[model samples]
Target: MENYKIPDNLAVSEEGFLFLPATGESFTLNEIGKIVIGLLKNGSSIEEIIERLTEEFDVDEHTAEKDVNDFLTQLKNFRLVEEI
Candidate 1:
């Protein structure tokens, strides 16, 4: 699976707040979204992300995969991340 990366123009806060300097846009992420973003930025693969989520959140593999894919889709839609 391809890895994802956050743009340098996107700024993230410890409290799950996101900002895009160039666009003057800001977003707030839920706990899971924040966790996913951190993992993505740290160079985690999609499978690795799903595994980590399952380990941390008491979620099953299928659900973890769905959620991770959905979140990544949303981030892509928002231009927050680019696939590599």
Candidate 2:
């Protein structure tokens, strides 16, 4: 499994608020998003993320995988995270 990283220009707050200094654009995320970002920042692998989500949220592995993939795709689309 590979890890993902949030770029330095992307600032994240305790309340799941994300800000891009270069573009002056900001976005807010839900609790789950915050957890995912935190885990990514901590160098957690993709599989680890799915496992954590399943355990914490009581979701099945298949559903967790789908949601996590969707969330990661959104982050990538917004240029918020990079494959590392």
Best by TM-score: 1
Model 1: per-residue lDDT, tens digit, 1-84?
678898977899999999999889899999999999998878888899999999998889998998888888889998999878
State TM-scores per candidate: 0.94, 0.93
The lDDT leader among the candidates is 2
* Regions of candidate 2 where Cα sits further than 4 Å from its true position: none
Which 10-residue window of candidate 1 scores lowest in summed lDDT? Answer: 1-10
Candidate 1: pairs in clash: none
In candidate 2, what are the lDDT values of residues 1-84, reduced to their tens digit? 556899977899999999999989898999999999989888888899999999998799999999999999999999999998
